[model samples]
Target: MNALILVADDEADMEPLFRQQFRRDIKAGRFDLVFTTSARQALRIIGDAGQHDILLLLSDINMPEMSGLDLLARAKAARPNLPIIMVTAYGDADTRRRALAGGADGLLPKPIDFPALRVEINRCLAQWGAGP
Candidate 1:
């Protein structure tokens, strides 16, 4: 099965970066990455359940319309079983604490480590029993 991953980040280059990083997995049909430039857009995807069967979400902490933390909370409330990982440049204690408190499945530091992300993704997939 191809797992859909929703990515919410304001960074313009993130889409290309993720595409390049997960090229193999994408081509293999292991994952389908969907990028949204804002939390609002992410919310739309989360809200419209009929459209996207999201298996995981990777969102940046800071955004223009709504913060990723807020997005995390909302997404979790809507889909408690959904695994959401918060990504941020600030990997400080407070940030991590807030993310955990908001029910984030994991946190990834900025300048994301693709190898580590791959492991994390696999872990989430396995936990949800949706691994390829």
Candidate 2:
């Protein structure tokens, strides 16, 4: 099955960038991405989808309604096996620690290095034995 990725970020600009960066994978049918501007919207998507096909979540740390950490916590509660990668412009040891404690599987600091991000994603998939 193709991996489903849920991307939550309040920034309107990020949507296009994410789509552009992951376009190849998306076209290859390696991943199905669901993008939302808010954590609440993401949660709604998860809830409405019944059985979530989501294998991973890529979320921004700072958001209006709910933070990515909160989202990670909720997603973990809903699906403990689901892996979440936290993305942020603010990268620090404390933030990383918090994310890890909150159940994040990985972290990507912005401005994101796309090549490194791709490597990390592949590594994550390999670790989960879900890679092609």
Name the runs in model 2 displaced over 4 angstroms.
49-51, 127-130
lDDT of each model, Cα atoms only?
0.90, 0.84
Query: Model 1: per-residue lDDT, tens digit, 1-132?
Result: 457899999998999999999898899887799999999999989999887778889999999879999999899988888889999999999999999989997899998989988998888777767674
Residue pairs in collision within model 2: none
Task: Tell me the deviation in Å of residue 34 in model 1.
Answer: 0.3
Question: Ten-residue segment with the worst summed lDDT in candidate 2?
Answer: 46-55
If scored against the real structure, what TM-score would every candidate get?
0.94, 0.88
List the candidate 1 regions with Cα displacement exceeding 4 Å.
128-132
Give the Å error, residue 100, model 2. 0.8
Model 1 accuracy (lDDT, Cα): 0.90
Model 2, total clashes = 0
Per-candidate RMSD, Å: 1.4, 1.9
Q: Give the CA lDDT, 0 to 100, for residue 66 in model 2.
A: 91
